[model samples]
Target: MDASRQIAARIEFLRRQLVDREPGPLRDAYLAVPTRERPVLQGTTTPALTQIWQQRPSGLITPATAETQPIDLIDVYLTFEEIFGFAAGPAYPVKQLQALPLGFVLQFCAELLNALSRPGASHSDVDRAFATQWLKEPIRTRVLNELRDPRRALVVPQALMLLARAAVEHSPDSLPDGAKPGNLIGALLAFSDMIGPSGEGGPTVLGEQPGDLGREVIANQYFNNNASVPHTFARYVRRWRELPQQFAGKDGLVDLPAVYEQCTGVTLDDLTVVAGALWAAACNGNVLTPTAELETLLPAGQVAKVLALISADLETLRQAVQSERARRHTEWTFDAFQQRPVIRLGAFLLVMDQRHLIDRAFGWLPILDVRFPPDTHPRPTNHEKLAGQAIRTLRRFSELYVSEVLHSITGQGTTTRRVYDDPELKAAFQGEGQKIADAAVDYGDTWVVVEVTTSQLQRDAATAVPGNAQVKDIDKLLEEVRQIDATIQALRRDESRLTGVSSQIRRRYLPLLLLTEGFPVNPVSMTVIRERAHKRGLLQGQDVMPLEVIDVEELEWIEALQEQQGVSLLAVVQRKQASSLERTSMRSFLADTITTPLSHPQRFEGKVSKALGPLEAVLLKRKQREP
Candidate 1:
């Protein structure tokens, strides 16, 4: 058999033996082998290993437990899901593979790793080993080539920004009536309400219900709670709500209340209440109930409307599954489920018969649609046009957002000024036909030059077989970096002209590049940028600080740490620079360097509340108007 077929055969054997059977015996058998004898359990400090062996079989993999693995085992499963299982046929039953206990999965993987270490093992011995060994080389190559490379992270942010802007720009006059952008947001909020921690003594959907093991598996595996949905919605409402009014002039304002009423057959206020009510009911162990249960909470018509907005029939889901399979075949890096048909139809709601409930369910993958919006229109051309417009809006928004974050970090006493607003600084660069940096902040003794870019990874670069696509994308980024380096060079050269300071003045200049999305700042990308910058003599002087690249998320995280915990931004940056030459993401760097008192969700929600307060007041008034 060929490598692919061989890999699939091994996976099928393991699935039959490990997944389709009761895991208790296997667990006991594996544990019975003394800890010293079980090489898989050796040298791992993860507490989960001990807990899993001691505790009763839970049959569910919690998010915390899943993270303890040495490698991203989820990705390993997804690789097979996309490449072999879905692409080939239902014979693979890839979704069922995820339902295997985390302990078993880890143990199996560990044993495979241990077996691979043994010298001169027979082909039959290797074949009898777990499937991970057969696909190890491909998995390893893919992980190194694509998975670990953070360039793919750029796609989701860009797609989300575009989708969001399209939603804001979507007009009521459009053909083929569909869910309004606000309705989509409402559905997302409802979905978030469903999955978020239940009220004390309230009905719980995730851990308490029968067949909830499957639900928890779906939630933990797919919708890992890196971001809070309500906070994300708040940010969206606060930011995009202003776009229509600002960009479209006096007549540009979208009446969101009217939009929601028209599309969802209920006012925004009613939708919110009904959505909450529905969440409570769904969580009350009614996963198998008909529409009647939902109707009891709201008007029949309204219930149908909400259901139509959020849920998809089995046929729709089947089609989406197929489309997703096709999408993976085409664009290997395109993993954002929001853009896929399945998530676009609705993420939280999946209509399956009682016989095909969570136990026999086809992995009810629930994507966080709030962070990643579905397509705004049916037509591809219209979607493209809106995406193009969103790019421009994103550019402007990124600059303002970065500026605001910097100003907040610098605080009230700091001198922060936009370079474009300063005539001298603008003119100084205009002579060389160059654009000035976005903003400048006088934080402590250092002069910080801020540059913001919404430049994203092109779709072609993310395709399955990117020929010249990757090269072209890298070239664009290098050019952007070079331009920023040139701008810094000019700023230093014309220091006396613009700031009335001598070139010999021992002034420290820190250049900060704020990306709207995350980019790979791995050794390769960083080395390339550094080498080019060094060749341009941008890093020659001791006065010039190394150019630090931080995405918007990291910037927000830093700002939160500074504001909430009194952490110093300058100190963080200096420490980061001093610590490593081969840079990782700023977020990862922050995680390693500082531990904040507030969790990410708390910090993010606090940040969003500042912007969402006014909007909430309006929403409150609308709610009060409800009888």
Candidate 2:
């Protein structure tokens, strides 16, 4: 097939694999179309994909105000239960239920759905239908009721956002002429409330507020700073200016101080007369202004117009103080303590600033969200000389601890606990310091003292913590430490002797045994025999075996002898003994016959004696006898 047809067939196979259905004619269509343009022809969903896509509505529709309609609230509640499998509290009172309108029921539905979606879905999904449905419900009343009923109000911000969006979506009339509107304040307020007093604002809903005049103002002034106290204050100040009617009295006159005090808890007189100066300084960017304001706001305060001014800027002031507090906490300067040539017992010198130390140890670090900060650098308050002495003592103590407990169990420097912070102790252990230092816990109490110096502890009884480490216990580490040391010493002493013996055994004896072929051998007996043979000049002095010294002619001769007899070298020695025995037997026979001839007893005796004497001599005088 051509390349294009092959490609078409491959595409059909992939479609079948993914969707579990054959492409068939569709494969031909796909091949006919241009590759890049094929993407446009694909449907939004296929049979395999539609099952997961359209199961739920596009957006999470939270609680909203329902339009006027006579409907069974119970039936709507049941519908939600059927759809989402969520449960609700005891049904609303039937009497109260009768007075409730369609709007109230829609609001209830939105809230119920939002609660159900929280665990699995995002808040955006929950906020989608808020514009049309949930927002129409009374935002404040619903929020207040949520606050009172903890169970129902458990999801404050999400519920509020839903209502806010619903109100914005339904109230086209609330927006200015020919201008698009959004639920900027409602979203912000909902976020702020959701955070509650603890400041957990939950997930951000939109990228940013849409472009609406009122929304832009709210976004920059209030929501921008998030956790910044000053930014929160600025936001409240702007909010006060925009919503004058909310703070106005029956006479239609705005009560500025009341609004400021309510939002920031600062009085007007205090703002103008006392904090007025600090406010001016802060506006000009003076660092000390916040501190100055704290002093003013706490003391005798002013009221009326002055209070109103302070109230207007309350959030700003709060933010400034918080910023100043944060700055002071982190502004630390290090002082190098001069080294004293000598240190006396009980000498007092500040080690570190209590404030910084406390903070470094346990202060709130917003980044980590937990305490237990690391003790970074240990700055010495004493002179270098004095500090050195203290470090020496600490190291000595740690080493002693390791030696006492770990040495007995595993041996002195061999253990893991013997290292220490002291220079002397570390030097003493040297390469083994890590091992010993690790065992410090086993030695004794391994507490670190930041306050006491080594010199002080030596001179004053009170300076030393009672029951310091001892030498005897340190000696116990010797048990474990000695194992490695002993092994090393033994090896050094015997290596030469063992190596020489092994070389002699392998070179001289091994080949001799191999050549003999059937020589009966025992390693222990062979070793003994070889040593004796060496002393007796049987083996050569050079330590090479004698047999090995033979040339190829001798080796071939020995090999041929064995081949002809079908016997090993051991049998050749036995055969030489048999030849000697036969010669002795012949001589003995001749002597005996000559002495006892047939009937001549007297003369035969004489002849026999002479013959026997000569024969015996000849028999005894054979060339050699078997060994």
In order, the Cα lDDT scores of the candidates are 0.42, 0.26
Number of backbone clashes in candidate 1: 0
TM-score of each: 0.49, 0.15
- Cα lDDT, model 2, residue 251: 32
Candidate 2 deviant stretches above 4 angstroms: 1-154, 158-269, 272-298, 303-627
Top TM-score prediction, candidate number: 1
* Candidate 1 TM-score over all chains jointly: 0.49
Q: Which tens-of-lDDT digit does each residue in 539-610 have in candidate 2?
A: 242422222111111222333333333333223222322332211111222222223322221212243233
Residue 388 CA displacement from its true place in model 1, Å? 5.1
Worst 10 residues of 1 by lDDT: 358-367
Per-residue alpha-carbon lDDT of candidate 1 for residues 304-407, written as tens digits (9 for 90 to 100): 65444444443443454455454442212223223321111222332211111111111111111211223441333343444444444534644555666676
